[model samples]
Target: MRCEAAPSATSPPAEPAAVFTQFVVKLYSRCNFGCPDCYVYEHRDRGWAAQPLVMSPAVMRRLSGRIAEHLRSHRPERAQVILHGGEPLLAGPPVLERFARRLRADCQGLTTRVDLLVQTNASRLDRAFLETFRRYGITVGVSLDGTAESHDRRRPDRAGRGTHAEVARALTLLRAPRYRPLYGGLLCVVDLEADPVETYEALLAHEPPAVDLLLPHATWHFPPPRPPDGGEAPYGRWLAALFDRWFDAPRRETALRLFDSLLDLYLGGTSTSEMWGPYGSDVVVIQPSGLIEYNDVLKTVSAEAARSALHIGAHNFDRAAADPGFAAERAGLAGLCAQCRSCPVVDICGGGLRAHRHSPDNGFDNPSCYCADLSFLIGHVRERLTHGVSMLRARFVQGRWSA
Candidate 1:
């Protein structure tokens, strides 16, 4: 939890501080599929257009060295290395294997645990790829929207053909007995227009241990679509409906991260996802070119929104941490807008995602574009929890009095 940099001999001794524990390495800058909602490829960020299609080995080596140095200096108990991309699988198995091996070697003995994972579209998963993943202990997390119709509508190949069949084949392979353990889960971006229960049920059919329902990245500059009438909080109502369905299920199903995080917060617990609660930025993004930046989700706000001057070739994690973007993100709740600070549910919503609050005029000093939706959802959750607890307490009192 320290926030001071390691001291150098030539300079005055400085305080020690926490370094990044999660590194998102973008192995490729181009995707095979053309998901219209993808933040990297289809959003306002055109930075990827300038990056190499694939990460060079020299850059990877430099990145590994930097990460190793950071791990040694900070000495965190555990670290996560996520292989991300426009489509990480596009880098192919050979590159992925070598990168994983090199990263593992570099971090040897520096940390207690190193967890490797890949966020892939699953279009290219095959036996060879699965074998490489299994050998390197890299768990695979697939990006799936829901039912075939819902998924294909948003995710299509360059030719504009549906990719659902290919992804489904990969899912079948992943769920096989031999490969099931390597299956991390499903990452689904929420489609408010889709039937919530139907989409939830479709995902359940996949038997994933967990599901992450992500809010499509948005800002006041590029707000998400709204109903014609603009009657109410569309996204919030959709989420609440899903939450009720999930909560009332006769048996426990897959872990719905968004709902679970909110429930945990309402029950006086903390959230693990940065999307909720006051969270210090412990994640860093390493581009294919070895440039360092804050979370890539910021790209949705603007092409240069998350860009940092530091690169893995020239700077260590400490230098990246000192960057203005990184510093602002790590500031947590202190970085929120004045309006967010005054809101009652600010503690739980964390002013929504930082990227969702961006504006050319106000910078990040504004409530999220989804501020109303977040308030509605959080209030709904609070009310439900309070009522449930009240009912339980009343039952207990009555039983005691009758006894």
Candidate 2:
């Protein structure tokens, strides 16, 4: 594959390098499970309804070849490919098998690592699926909320019954010694009403390697329900409690990405995802139709799915990286708020996730939707550490004086 410099002169400086790390290929727009809160279907956009049920083989081939050529030029070896969708498992064995094999074959000589990952609801995770995952060294992330009651409320089947029991059974099969290594972790959406302890306990029973807690999506236009006047909403409170419990828990078993990002910000680091800061450069998503898009959130911005085309074929990665609009959006992370710019802890906070920062009117240049919750949690964590440091210093002084 031949490589060419970006035609646009608005390329970023060389030192920081491109952070284009992951590409989520929407393999299908159809899913077997029906979660009441799914953004793809439940949101007002209704775009997924129009997308083809599955990615065409021609588009997939073009995407795979294009990505390989892009990697050859850009050489960001850590770039990953996630088989995303209504449910990636909906592609079944033959499709996934071909996709993975072709992806691996296309970029054989490049130093970059192309990880094949599947984000599934675990409904169709039978022996065949597990076998495919193992064969390709694919990491499988299953979406399961907490206990039956909490999980059932939001994540249900098309028939209106809770899918918790069925998902759990599938997960158990995945962990049944034979397929344990292929399992990545559990992806759970936060339910504000459920007790944090109870939810945590329920999830811990399953022993997934990691747990990702996702906040529900809403906007100023469609703001999440708030009290009549005075009382605070339960969403932030629930997350705060979970953070507290995770901190106080006897053993740390699960890898919570949200908490990890928060901790990174609190400790003065930028987040890996656009959600945490103004990071605009390092990410990209490949749709089933062979187009390159920024975070999938941009789908809400335009009805023409083809709006984000930087370089459509297999070789546009670096060119997209050099886009002026992309750079401006990324730099916008730091200017999120006056408070964030001057805040003592802005490095770690990164002004929160881009999705939360997005206001239809303001683009992605605003404060987080969970600004209150984030500020509250960061304050609490800071205080705990500061007090601990003071106590240790006092003890040291006392010992020296006594001696």
Give the best candidate by lDDT: 1
Model 2: lDDT of residue 66: 74
Cα error, residue 375 of model 1, in Å, equals: 0.7
lDDT of 1 by residue, 235-317 (tens): 89888888888988999998888888888887789987777998757889999998888888898988788898888888888
lDDT by residue for model 2 (319-399), tens: 676665455446654556676677665665667655556666966556667667667766776776678689999999999
Which pairs in model 1 have colliding backbones?
2-17, 2-18, 3-17, 4-17
Residue 175 error for model 2, in Å?
A: 1.3
lDDT of each: 0.87, 0.72
TM-score of each: 0.94, 0.86
